[model samples]
Structures are given as structure tokens and as C-alpha cells.
Target: MTVEYWRAKIWGLLHDPVLKALHNNSGRGKNSFYKQLEVMKPWVETGKTPDQSGGKVLENILLADYIASASDRSAIGSVTASINYAPGKNREKGLEITHLLSGARQEWKINSHDELIKGKRKDYLVQKEQKELLAKVPKELQDPSIKDDIKKIKQLYWWLWRCLPQATCDLFKDNSLMLMPAETRIPDASIWSHVSMTSALAGALAGYDLTAAQIQRWQGNDELSHPYLAVFSFSPVQELIKSSRKMRDFWAGSWLLHYLSAKVCWQLANQY
Candidate 1:
């Protein structure tokens, strides 16, 4: 497949909720899904691999998958009921998800996260948005001469991390639930947090300067001998709510804490 094809395929995979739901049953698979996309950054941006052999590209992809799987063991026991259902089985009855804006339960389909955020309420109907975003993959792969459009790819990446969250928050009735979950397995973490951490992890891996051969040798090993790093941040909210006199005060304190936390995240994002 051409680089454009991989770009489109990665983009389509991330935006397709059905595909994510299908592949992300286990935490390792979910992390690997995103990690592989991150590892493809060089190909996605330059339309070329590290060398002429084309072997390094495959090595990088495998390395990313391996690292992601080995790094997280917390989700091994968190399998859900949806894992057993076949693809489109839930779609036949119409899948229901908590509406990000209203928190009201609704039957819907998310083909593209960007489109869903921009579309009206009626646009969410499963039959109305039946087109699969992955339909363009074959066409992209067939056209090897297609020019690399880095700007558009970057925009899609930006929309995934930035615009989608803003739009969701703007439409949400409750500030307490403004952020979207990164994955169903980890409901407390926001999608922004996951993406930011993935970016950071990818950056650290790049700086480590490990060769393809070394990564291949290390694959499937159960040791945490790799340079992977996880950073955690904590914000104490008890003090913020300690002075609350009423229920409204408690809500206000919580909103303030969320707002401040978001500000810190945005600052960190800007620094990079």
C-alpha cells in the first residue's frame, strides 16, 4: 500500500466508532491501534520510509504494537459484553451511546468524528450516515502517484485532538461531564489525555534511537526493559470544595477544578 493509503486508512480507523469498538475490546489492542498510527508519522508526513529496503517501516510498526501491548496490563481483565457480538450485529438493532452533548441516550452511528461534531441532530441517524469512511481506502491504495497532502493530514490530527473536544463541550449541558472518554476500558481518562500521552510516548521513543534490529529482537519479550515512560499528574480538588456552602457551590468548585486542569493541559500541549 502507498503512504497515502496508510494515512487514509489510519484516519478512517480512528474515526470509525464501530471499528474502534471491535478492535479495542482488550486494552493492549486499543493501545496498539493508536500506537501504530503514531508510529506511521514519518510515512504519513513524507510519503517515504526510513530506507530503500522498506523493511524498517514494517519493523517500526511491529515495535509500536509490541510496546503498546507490553506496557499496559491493567485492562487484561476488563473485557465487556460487546466483544462477543459480531460486526454490524448491534448496528442492525441500531447502536446506542450516551450523547456527548445532552447526555441523553440515543441510537446513532459515528462514521467520522469530525462530521459527527459538525452535523445536526438528524445527521446522527444510522441510516442517514450509512457511508463507511474506510470506503476511500481502496481508491487511495490504487493511486500510488497521489501527492502527499501533509496539511490535510495534520488538520485531521488537529481536529481529532482539538476541535472535537471543544465542540463536544460547547454542546454539553453538564460541565461535570464535558470531556469524552479515551476508551470505554478507561472511562476516567479523557480522549485528550490519551492522545497527548501517546504523542509524548512517541517522542520519547524517537529520542531513544533504537535500531530496527534491536526492536525486532526485543519484540514479544515480557520484560519492561524498553525506554517507555509513563507520566501521571494529580490535582487535589478537596481543598477547592472544602468551603462549599451549597450544592451549587460544590458544582461550581468542580467546574473550576476542571477548567483549571484543562488550562494546564493546554499549556503543556502548547509547549511542545
Candidate 2:
């Protein structure tokens, strides 16, 4: 499929069944639901125009699934229920299950050690493990990408780290027995990081080996101590890494081949 195909598919997935279900279920925060719809309405009414809302529309669209999943009973009840249920069959899966958007951006790079610490939610990380983990991130990841979009990708990684604690807490909270909130909405930090990281991870999975290399080092402990590593140890990552050669092949043949390969090639081809 072309990038346009995946883009439209993702949009339709969010705007149709997801949003439609939200409209009927006030239990899932009618305000948040409508807010998402409002952000998406321009595109829904028009077509695949530019992200004129400066990512706000995409943000709202993605959050809609999380909002829907927060409901115990609602218009989009069964659909959300199924989508939300997949993660944590084993805790080792970490927070990767929370990735809501498919075909997300996937440029993963850890730059400044200090910035990386901040992104990991310094307040939540074990001081010593944090230092070691940061130290171990391969020096290679810091090499500037030959591509033009490294700035944007770096910003995404930064935001993902920024959003880690809150989003991690929200997605994995033990709310199984608690009553569903009248409106289930995460803070803006979670929303921003969620979309940003999804893209970053997507980039990493598509052969940005540095991301996987970093993930391996971060997941060094069985405790899943590192915040981002713990939450991001989901199935897609495992599948993405398994049979690395084959995965790379599939990646090249897939639509991301068109989307990500061109970008990667641009960077590598220009590296001199």
C-alpha cells in the first residue's frame, strides 16, 4: 500500500468505527470524544490534506482509541475492549501494547545523556541503573542522520521520553476493578509522547538498528527497570527484531519501504 493508503486507512479506522462508537457513548468522555471529532472533522469532511492542525488532529484521533478503551460499557464497547485487552498477557511485554497508531513514525535516536535522563522521567528511574543505562546506549546512535528530518525525529524521541511516566502509568494502571471514570482522558503529555513515540518506534522497527540496539541495552535487567524500555517491550518490538535479516527484508518490501527507506537512504547516501 502507498503512504496514502495507510494514511487513509488509519484515518478511517479512527474516524469511522472508533469515533462513531464514541459519539454514542457518553461514558467515554463525550467532551473528549467530541474534541477528537472536532480536530478530525476538517479531514473527515475534506480529504487527506496536510496536517494543518499541526499534529493536533492526529493527536486527537489517536487518543480516541485510548479514550474508548477506558470505558467498561459504551457505544464502541466491544471494539475498544478487544483492542485494549491485547497487552500484558505477560508483564514482560512492557508498555508496547499501548501503541495505538499503526504506521507511526519510527526515527529513534538518543542524543544528549542529560536529555535522555529527563526523557526517562528522572523522578521514576533508579539513580544507578539510569546512569548505567545511559552510559550503555551505543555511541553509534548519536551519529547525525544524513536525512533532513533528524530534527523532527529527535524531537519525537524527546517527547516520548517526556511523556513516559504519565503515559506509562495511565496505560498500565490497575483499574481493572475500579469504576470507569466518567471520562477517560490522559494528560496532554501522554498524548503528545504517545503519537510521537509510536512514530519513533515505527522508524526503529523499520531498520533504524540504533533504536533496537538501545532497546536491548535498556532491557538488560529482568525487572524491566528502565521506564521507556519497560513500557515499550511490547510484541511488535519482539516481532520486529526476531530474525533480523528476514525482518529487514519484509521491511524493505512493505509500504514503509517507500516511506522509511527513502528517508533512510537519503541519510546514508549523503553520509560522507
Candidate 3:
């Protein structure tokens, strides 16, 4: 609201038809279970190639392998991809979204690395993880061109991230983070709520020096935010639980706004 740049992003995410569908189908399954996924309506951007965008994370290993072995760029010509641009004054919304999204992603990655991949020893663990990842990578990666060249993959991965706005991206490293305790229970999915969960906190940090009171109080539904405090055995999760919130007010406001805004963005993204 403070920045005019987010106007299009906010409006687009809030009004996207995909979000309408998700909003319409909040609780449909057994246990009256709800859908937490907020789809975003995508307004396709032109002039950028998919390769220029973020490489497909799920499919990156294979894609990178093929791209590397290719005699030329033609081999990767039809590969599906998306380019990410960094956010800044020129792209307030992008900055706002990137801040929160990437920050959360970093947490997820860090948690994943610590719990599943490496357990917080980035320099130490990254090399080991990459080696293991190399084993799972398909034969194409065996190519001398691509093998052991994680730097290229990291570069492309970051390139995809470029599409996101920068203001938001910085939230990963900011002080205004949310801290909370929650629990969730659904069929085959029983877990605790997130810690200071919400991308708004990140967004606020990106936009300006937002205070705690700016975000409205959260009304949890299975849809937007979760409700519970059951913890899990994931190795790094306990560490997250121990993680402290540097600022409480910022945490609350940021988490709240981030949730609502992402709801719109996710819906809009799904439409395309």
C-alpha cells in the first residue's frame, strides 16, 4: 500500500481468476480439509526467453545436462524455462515479491540443507551435497562440459530468481522477520505451523522501514494461514524452533501482509 509500484502486483494477484477458483473451493475434501495453495493469475511477460529466465528447478538437473552436452544452444531451444529479474526501484512489486519469496526459499533451502541436504554447513556441506546430487543426476550430466560445473547451474538458478523484485528479495537478510508457533493436521499431512510465517514481513522490509502495527491481525483459516503447534522430527526443524525473532511487531505485520499478497500472486500465477 505504501508503494505505488506494487499496485499492479497487488491488484493482479488479488483479482486473478485462478485465485477466484481457489477462494471458491477453500474446503472441499474429507475432514472438510482446505486448500492452502493460492493460485496466481499470470500475465505473461514478453521479450524474455525461458532460458533467460529461471531454469526449471524440478527439472534443472536433466535440463542442464542436456544443455551442456548439446553441440550448440539449439539442443536447449525448446526446453521450458522462465527468466527471473532482480527487483529494485524500477520494479517495486518484483522487489517486494522477490524479497519475501526468496527469503522464504532461503529458509526452506537452509532448513532442507541442514535437515536433508547438509545441515547448515554451507561451504562444507554444499560440496558434499553436490557430489551426492551428481550421482542422482542423469547420464547427460556426465558430460565433461557439465560435470562438476555447479557454478553454471547456480548462475542460471539465480538468473531465474532475477525475475523477482529485489526489494522483497532482501528480506531474507533483513531484521523484520516473523516468529510464531503453529501446528497442522490433515490426511497424510500432519505438521506444525511455521515460525514467524508470512511473506508480508519480507515484503514490508523490502518496501520501507515498516513497523509492527502496519499489518492487520491474522485470521487463520486452513486456507491462508495454519493453526497448530505440533513439531516434527525433521533434523533442522528443532533448530528453527530455537530460532528467535529479532523483531516481534515487524514479524506480525510482515507475515500477515505477505500471506494475503501471496494468496493473490499464487492465484494469478496459476491462471496462466
Candidate whose lDDT is highest: 1
lDDT of 2 by residue, 193-255 (tens): 333333333232222222222222324332211112322122354465454577666665454
Task: Write candidate 1's Cα lDDT for 83-195 as tens digits.
Answer: 31123343233233444445566433333434433444233422221232222223433233333454544544454445544443333322332344444443344444444
Ranking by lDDT: 1, 2, 3
TM-score of 2: 0.19
Better of 1 and 3 by TM-score: 1
TM-score for candidate 3, residues paired by index: 0.16
Between candidates 1 and 2, which one is better according to TM-score? 1
lDDT at residue 201 of model 1 (Cα atoms)? 42
Model 2 ranges with Cα > 4 A deviation: 1-148, 163-272
Judged by TM-score, which candidate is best? 1
Candidate lDDT scores, in order, read 0.39, 0.29, 0.24
TM-score-based ranking, best first?
1, 2, 3
Model 3 ranges with Cα > 4 A deviation = 1-131, 137-249
